[model samples]
Structures are given as C-alpha cells and as structure tokens.
Target: MGKPTGFMEYDRKDNKAVEPLERIKNFNEFHTPMSDKDRATQAARCMNCGVPFCQSGMMINGMASGCPLNNLVPEWNDLLFHGNLEKALQMLRQTNNFPEFTSRVCPALCEAACTCGLNGEPVSCKANENAIIEYGYANGLMKAKPPKVRTGKKVAIVGSGPSGLAAADQLNKRGHDVTVYERNDHIGGLLMYGIPNMKLEKWVIDRKQKVMEEEGIHFIVNTNVGKDVKAETLLKEYDSVILCCGASHPRDIKAPGREAQGIYFAVDFLTRSTKHVLTGKKEGWVDTKGKNVVVIGGGDTGNDCVGTAVRQGAKSVVQIEMMPKLPDQRAANNPWPEWPRVCKTDYGQEEAIAVYGKDPRIYQATVKEFIADKNGVLKKVKLVKLEPKKDPKTGRMNMTEIQGSEFELPADYVLIAAGFLGTEDYIAKAFKVKLNARTNVETKPGKYQTSVDKIFTAGDMHRGQSLVVWGINEGRHVAREVDEKLMGYTNLP
Candidate 1:
C-alpha cells in the first residue's frame, strides 16, 4: 500500500456533477472530473485489505458483491497512489477491456464491497478508474498496437455490442483474423443507440472503434448476420462463429390499446432519439416536446426515458413501477460486503425532480389499460395501486391490484421500459441454436459453447440481459475459449 494511514487522512470525494436544471438543456455528460492529485488521494483510500473482497466477484444473497471482472482493484489503487499513472493504466487494462464505459455506467460493485464503506464512505474506485483510462488516452498511452504476425485463422463475431467488441479485441490481439458484423448502420450495438447521449456520448464509441480498426479488426456495419448475410455463409467461411448478439426482445405491456399510435418500446424510443441527435434531422422522429409522457417500468431505462423527455420539453413526466420503493438505507437482511438493496436516486430521476417539482416515480403502481383518442392515438392511462401478498399455492410474494384504486392520467406518449425477455427468436433460429426456457441461448454450464459445433455465445444473448461489465467479462472468457480451441493453447488472460 502507498500509505497505510491514507484511508484515515482523506475523506471520500467524487466528481462534481453539473446542476440538474442546467444539465438538462444539453445531452452531454454532466460530470466534472477531479484533478489528478485529488484522484490519487481517492485511490490512496483503497486500504488494500488482507482479504480484499472488492474484486471477489462473488454472488451473495442473489446479488453481485464485487467486480465481476475480478479487476485488480488494490494493485491499481496502489499504483495510482504511488503516482505511477502508466502502471495504474496497465493494471486496469489487465482485467477490464473498457474501463471508460464501466466507470461511467457501472453501479460500482467494487465500491459496494469496499472495506472502507463497511462503516464509512467507500473509496472512489469508479472515479479513479475513469481517471486512469482518460489519462492514458490524453497522454497517448492508449494507441493502436497491431499484432505483428497473423495466425491464419478467421473468426467471425456477430453483434458489435460490449461482448462482441471485447471478444473481437481479444481475438485480434492474439493475431487471429477477426471480423465484427453489426446490424445497425454504426458500430456499438446498445452503447450507440439504446443509451442516451447524455450518459455516454457517441464520439467516445467512435474513438474506440477507430482504434480497433487501426489494430486490424474489421467492422462491417449495416450487415445483419442472419438476414443480410446468411448464417450458412458465416459457418462455411469462418473457422469459428461467436454470437454476441444482445438480448433485444423487449417485454411488452399487454393492456388494451397497446397498439395505440403514441406507445413505443423504450429501446425504440431511445434509439430514435439518439439517431435524431446524431443525424440532426427531425423527419420520422418520435417527438416528446410539450407532450405528457408516461414511462412504464422504474429501472434505469425508465429513468433514461424521463431524462430524455424532460430534455425535449415534455409538459409532464411520470414513471410507474410495479414494485414497492426500496428503503433509503440498507435493511437488516442486507449487510456489509453484500450488494445493498436500497433506494438510489439516479441522474435522470434527479433531473426529473428538478423539472417536475417532485419525483417522477410512482412506486407500487402499474398501468392497467390505455385510453386512446378517436384516431387510435394514446390519450390517457388507467393506473392501479398494488399490494404485495403471498400466493396460496406457490407461497411466493406477488403483486395484486387494490380494489377501487384505479385512476386515470392524461398521456400523450407512452414508453415501455420494463426490460427485455431475452434474445429475439429469429437470430437463434437462424443459427439453429437451442434456447433455454428463459429464451436465452443455451450454452454449457460455465462454458460459452452452444449446442451446435463451431458456434459459441456470450453476453445478453447467452446469459440473458445483464450489466455491461458482465458482458465484457463473458466476452473475454469466450475469446480465451475460442483461442484455446483453435491453437491448442491460449495466452489470453
């Protein structure tokens, strides 16, 4: 450890955020980064525990406890504290393929399990990670380093999301000829479109893509693997085919008037907005300006919808969640070193509160049905309050709507952000891969291989929709498996 008593000396400090009211006017990142010295002080608080659980990546009480990538947290923190910026970057890159992405978006499971946080504020590990990566980029430490020799093996990776990109990066570094195929016109599957620009700018993705291209990995955009390019063609042409296609099958709202003109899936809404922002065009766009917006499902996606709507000058915004709100502090059941199941106010919710004078979220409530206008455009939604009760047969908790509690609210646009079911059936069918009961690609337990020979799967497609960090972790693991299978040995970490 750089300083044994550093934790006692320094108080936790994080990046400054732009004021919610001011930040909502533009779709850029709202965080103001801390200075290098301050970041080093933050890193110095790592503690370097005798048994550091920060990188354990353990599943405790059905939730993740630490970094799933098993990132070398202590090592990098020590390096940063010692003012070895390059070494810190090296240690960070050893595990995470994209720290920049995770630092900005990841919930920071590492911080949740931090020893310091057991009683006090945790070290700013996430911010330190972001600082290290951004420093590397600024100092030109991150550059194209193409493999000197080719392995004469061709690998095809479908989907250019986090998992696919990670796999492609790993395989390309191993001197294998790798090509990534993306269905969208641009690379970065969800990162480019599903996420709002305010959280992660498109130029960041573009910059990484440029570096990957310079490193000899080829990217083919606007090419749907199963449709535009036949699955049979990839099977025949490539030595191995890795499917990192994300689980994009959106879960739908099955109430009456679901087919209304103004209702849209959250992904579709976000994609449209990002595309409009990138292209600077309004033709065929879903406008929320001066509209009463109702967002269903109270997760990150729903919050993103709220932020986006507010940015577009929405008249009113309401986010409905079927589940009850969590406690502000950790409950008795959730203890230290376990991922805390507590209420969190994300960036979008803060902006919503600032704009609407109250939190946009309506907990313990759900939309019962949609009321539409004569032209089939959505106008109002019938919402019902719910109560949690034990089911007689299953003995499991379930939500039931309360009697005489239904109410209606005007709604000009409805966005369903209730999460995804699994991967779309078409992609699974195209590859002739078996799907699990959950509709996810069925790979061997603790393995990335699918039922079909020469076919492997990773990320949301294989594991169901999950965190981006998990996608990157699986991608790296799948690449190691593919490398070992092809060359009889692999040096990939």
Candidate 2:
C-alpha cells in the first residue's frame, strides 16, 4: 500500500526522453530520469487495490498479467511514498537481483495490471523501480557482500546473460564456487552487444559485473562452451551444469535472393553495431551510412535496428510488421484491468519521425522476394499485402497474401528481426536433452531436471524466447531447485 489518498492526489507522470532530433545524432540513451521527488509521487499513485493483482503474476486469458518475480511492489511503493529511500531499496533487492537491467528494458507487466490503469493511466511502476535502483547505486548502498560459508561446491555457468548472471548470483550466495563462462569477449551477452548503449549504458553493466566479481563469482570471457571449450568437459567438471545459453537463433525469412550480401540477422546486426560503439572504431562493423535499410519485424529488436540505423546515418529506414495495424484504443477483447493492446509510438518510431518526417513502420506486409544484383547485393524487395485468415484445424488466424496486392520497395539492405525459434542446435544436442513441441529444451515448469540427471535447463533455452525478467526468475528458481536436489535442503534467493 502507498499513501492512502495518493491515487486521488496525483495523476501518473510520464517518463522523459531526449528530443528525437537530438537523440538521432548519436547512439546514446535518450531517456532522462524523472526527479527524485517526481518519481516518488509516481510511486505513490499505486492504488490500494484489495486484490493487488499487479504483483499476483496470475494468468488472465492464459497470458502473464503482472510481475513474474512477484516483487514486493506494494511494500516498496509504500516505503518510497514515505520518503524511506534506503528501506525501499532494501525491499526491492530482496526479490530482484538486477533491477538495473529490468528497469531499462522490461515490458513492465506490473504496470499493465495496476488497478489505477483500469479506468485511466497506470502508476509509473517501471520508473519507480528504476528510481530506487539508481538511488541505491548512487548512495553506495548497492555493493558486493559475499556469502559467509563455503559449501565447497564448484559450478560452471555457460552464459553471462540475465539468466546466467542471476543463477551465478544465487549459487555464489549458497557458497558454491561459481565461474561464469561467457562465449563473447564481453561479459554481458545481449546486454552488452545486442542492446544499444544509449538506452542502457555499458557502465551500468560493468558496475554490476564488478560487484559480482567482488562476491567471488569468476567470469571467463571469450570462452564459448561448444567451440573454445567443450560442452561435455564443462558438464563433467562442474557439480551440475545449468544451461542458460539463451535462444540465440534468429528467425530468418526465406525468399528469392535472400542470400544477398547486405542481408543479416537482427541479432548479428545489433551485435556488430554495439561492438563498434564499445571499441570506438567502425572497422568490421555494420555501417549504414547512406544505405537504404529495411528491417523485417515490429518487435523490440526491430525498433532497436531502426534506432541504430538512424544513428548510423542511413539514407532511409523502413520497418515492416507482418501483422495488421493495431487499434488506437484497447480492443474489446483486451478490456480494462488487462494489458491494453493499443497503438503507441516507441522510441525508435519517434526517432524515425524526427529524421524521416513520419513513422517508418508499414503494417500487414509479407515479403515476396529480395531482388539482388549480379554481385549478389540486394537492390530491391518485392512485397505483398497480407490478410488474416483462420486455420482449418487449429482455428488460429494465419496471414494470407492477397492476389493483386503485390508491390515493390527499394531496399538496399535487409535485417531480419523476426524473433527467435528457441535454443540453438548444438548445446542441447551435446547434452542430449529432449525437445518440447516448440523445439525448446523440454522440461516440466518449475522442475528443471533435464533428461540427463546432473544437467538442467532454464531461461529462454527451456521456456522459449521471452522477456529478461522471466529469464532471471527461471535462473534463480532453477538454481534453488538444483541446490536442494544436490543437498537435502537449501537456502537460495
């Protein structure tokens, strides 16, 4: 609970962003934090709903309706409302290990289920979380405090993304000897390479890494599990292997001339861009200077591609989403108290508007083919309009191309940000874990024991591509389960 009358007293304040014109000039984070006082007021707007569905993490229509971590939202909100910053930070860290990353990129399911959002706008739960985390770090309240006992167990984590980091944090807290093996040279996977630094500064990740290192969690960079280091060898060396390698497979679009030189996966493109930004050099990086770029997807990765392309001084940026246009207001199916499915401009769209004079997204598009030159460089794209149709068996709506709706677009470069298709092929193949119907490493929910007795899988590799918060949650939960299975009982967070 927050201030009893806070919801009546204050309307929710919005997050501030740098002007699109200014932000597009360089690849820097455009978000500007709300003042401490303002962020507190925003937190105070959390209504004292008797049900408190915002933290329930319940299934409404078979979709997650709130924070999966079930964070102590109300307690922290009330703590912040009373100007108890230190107490709020303590309450926040009890549940979430890395609020910094989630604060920047999380979808904020909690805000979607906020009671205040039913009739009007939601409380700024996301911003409030960001505020407390930032405040703790600024006041030196966030630092390393390693566990007191040594369990004498050695664990090898195969990834350094959110899930891996969360697992490592939990295991190290149990006094397990933990060494994280990151394939890339950098420790943070998508956080360092896939995400642009402006939205999330590299230093924030570095700061967290320093704290983890201080807590005795060893991180080995540039050591890939399947390549540089053998996967089987790791499984034998560690007490138990937790596969949090994440779903790195980028979904590709098949069409004529798709093998053109200018085409690349969205993950690869974003990774290369971040590499250049991190190193302060443009060599071997994906350069968009004076090139016509077409990104095929409408998700966050696609938006990130647009923003990065704009910053790289591309001639033009066009994004195509296969789905039909969304409604300006919530559809009847998505009523109040549920996450509203409505049209709203994201950061990349705002940047596109500033540079191109309009938003760069076209809805209901299907690629017919990619037209390439003799040298195998893309020159243009042939497209067709799509209409939703119901499947005969599943009854689910499928996109169908309309006859005579074909057209062509000038696309010099194509980036496929079509999302992921579950875990990669080799890691799970090495472990010989069974695949679920969705091709993800199969396991019962909350029971991460893989087909192999000592092996376990969690995060996107097991659950399918999802938000970072869920990855952290799964990793923490699996670490606890593994600890309990190894010993008779355990204490892990």
Candidate 3:
C-alpha cells in the first residue's frame, strides 16, 4: 500500500463527466480526465488486502466477484501511487490485453467486489486504470511489441470481438501465426458497432488493432466465414480454428404491428448508429431527429438506444421494462459481494434524466401493440401493466399482463433491445457443433474442447451472452486448451 491511511484520509473522488446539456451536443467522449494528483490519491486507496479480492476474479454465489481477467489491481494501483507509470502499464498489460475498452464500457466488477465496498466506497479501480492507460498512451509509453520468433503454426479466429481478439493475442504472443476474420468492414466487432462513440471511441479500438497487427496478427475485414468465405476452407487451411462469433441472435418481441417499418431491433439500431458515426452518413438509417422514440427492454442496450436517440435529437425518449422496479439498495437476503440487483443510473440513464425531467426507464410496463401510420412507419406504442406469474407445473416465474391498464404513447421509432438468444447458426452448422438447451455452444466444465476434435470454442459462442471480461477469461483458457492440443505441453500464461 502506498499510504497506510490513504483510504481513510482521501475520500473517493472520480473523474467528473461533462454536464448533460453540453455533452448531448456532440458524439465525442465527455468524461474529463482526472488530474494526476487526484488519480495518485485514488490509486493510494487500494488496501492491498491479504487475499486481494480486487484481483481475484472468481465466482462467489453465482456472481462474478471482482476483476474478470483477474487483473493485478493492488499491484498496479501501488505502482501508480508512486508515479511509476511504466511499471503500472506493464502490470496492467500482463492480464488485461485491452484495458482501454473495459475501462470505458465495462461495469467495473472490481469495484462492486472490493473489500472496501463493504464499509465505505471502494477504490477507484476503473477510473484509475482509465487514467493510467490514458497516461501511458499520452506519454508515448505504449508501443508494438511483436513476438521474437515465429512458431509457424497458423490460427483462424472467427469473430473479431473481445474473445477472439484475446485468444489471438495470447496465441500470437507464443509466436503462433494468427489471422482474425471479421464480417464487418471494421475489425472490432461489437466494439466497432454495438457500442456508441461517446462511451468508447473508435480510435481506442483502432489503436489496439494497430498494435495487434504489429504483433503479427492479421485481421481480414469484410470476410465472413459462413457467407463470403467458406468455414470449411478455414478448417482445412489453418492449423486450428477457434469459434467466437458470439451470441448475436437478438431476442424479438412478437407483438401487434411487429412488422412496422420504423420498428427495429436494438442491435440493428446500435450497429446502424455506430456505422453512421464511422461512415458519417445518417441517411436511410433510423433518424431520431425531432421524433418520439420508445426503446423496449431495460438493459444496457435499451439505455444505449435511449442515449443514441437523444443524441440524434429525439423529441422524447421512454425505456420500458417488464420486470418490476428493483430496490435502491441491496435486498435483505442479498448480502455484499453479490452483483447488486439495484436500480442505479448508468451513463445512458443519466443522460436521459438530464434531458428529460425524470428517468427514462419505466418498470413493470410492457408493450402490447405498436401502432403504425398509413405508410407503415411506427407511430406509437401501446403498453399495459406487467405482473409476475408463477407456473402451476414447473413453478417457474414469468410475466403476466394486467387488464384495463393499457395505454398508448407517441413513438416515431421503436427499438427492441430484448437481448440475444444465442449464437448465430451458420458457423455452428458449418462446424456441426452441438448447442446446449440454451442454444449456446456446448462445452464441458473445466474444458474448452468441442465434439469436433482439434476445434475449440470460447466467449459467448461457447458460453451464453455475457460480459466482455468473461469473454477474455474464456479466450485465455481456450488458448491454453488449443496449445495443449497442438504440442502436448503448453507454456502460455
């Protein structure tokens, strides 16, 4: 610990963001960087506990406890405390390959599971990492460190998202030839499209990709294995193929007026908006200019839709959730360390609340019908009260609608951010891979092996749709599996 009494002396102070009114004017990042003095103090707050729960990315009571990549939180924090930024960057890069991406969009699990969080606020792990990485980049400390020797072994990684990227990075570090395939014109799959610019700028992903390229990882854009290129060809050409396409099938809301023209999926809306930002074209896309927009579903994607609509000059925005509202604090039975199922404002919610008088999310409400205009453009949404239901046979919980409590609201565009169901079918079918009941790629515990010999799966493709941190974990483990399969014994860490 840099300062024995730092946590007590220095109260938690994080990076301040740009005011809502001013931030909504552009699509650029608004969070002002924390001063070096403030960041150093925050870094000093790391207690460096005996167990270091901040670096112990293990599951406790079915929830992620701390850093998913098991980042050396306390060590890096101490390094930063002494202003040894070089050592801090090296320690940060040891585990997390892309701290920039996680530092921005990730829901800092490290903070929630921090030992300090039990009594007082936790150390500013996320903010500190952000400050450190930005510091490294600004000071020209980060550079391309390619492998020393080539292993001559080739790997074809499907899906250029976090999982695939992490796997390729690890394998490349071991001197293996890696080629990443991306369907989109850009390299960073979800990061390039699903996330917005205000949260994670494109340049962040671009910089990482450039570094990986220098490390001998080849990224092939506009080449899809299932459609553009054959998956069988990849299996034959590469020594090993890793599937990481992700659970991309967006769950749908099959309600009245489901086929309305302006009504779209949340993924589609996010992807289009991001593409527009990257391409600088807003024509033919879902333009929220002076239009009332209703985003169905209350997860991160729904909130993203709300924020994107607001930035596009949405006249009004309302986010709907079928689940009942959660308590502001942890429930009685729910103790510390569990992922707090509480109602808290995210960036999107804060932006919406700053613009609209109140929070944009409305709980215990669901859409029954989407009214459309004569031209088939979505005009408005018809909503009804929602209640919890118990199954008579299985005793499973479900949602039931309340009668005589239906209402309609104006909406020029409706975005369904109901989340994903499972991985896409093409790659799975091409490889003849088996899926579990949830439709995710089937994999046994403590194993990354698949039914097809020599082939492996990871990330959301093998597991269900989950956090990017989990994807990184799966990638690292899968790289170990592939390495073991290749040369009997592996030395990757």
Top candidate on lDDT is 1
Clashes in each model (backbone N, CA, C under 3 Å)? 0, 2, 0
Q: State the lDDT of candidate 3 residue by residue for 395-490, as single tens digits.
A: 998888888999999988889999899988888898888888898888888788878866789998888888888888889989988878776779
Q: Candidate 1 has what TM-score? A: 0.99
Candidate 2, pairs of clashing residues: 28-198, 29-198
User: Which stretch of 10 consecutive residues in model 1 shows the poorest summed lDDT?
Assistant: 277-286
Clashing pairs in 3: none
lDDT against the true structure, each candidate: 0.93, 0.86, 0.87
Steric clash pairs (candidate 1): none
Q: After superposition, how far is residue 365 of candidate 1 from its true place, in Å?
A: 1.0
TM-score of each model, paired residue for residue? 0.99, 0.97, 0.97
List candidate 1 segments past 4 Å from native: none
Model 1: per-residue Cα lDDT over 162-232, one tens digit each: 99999999999999999999999999888889889998898889989989999999999999888999999
Ranking by lDDT: 1, 3, 2
Reference-based TM-score, model 2: 0.97
C-alpha displacement of 402 in model 1, angstroms?
0.6
- Quote the lDDT for 416 in model 2: 94
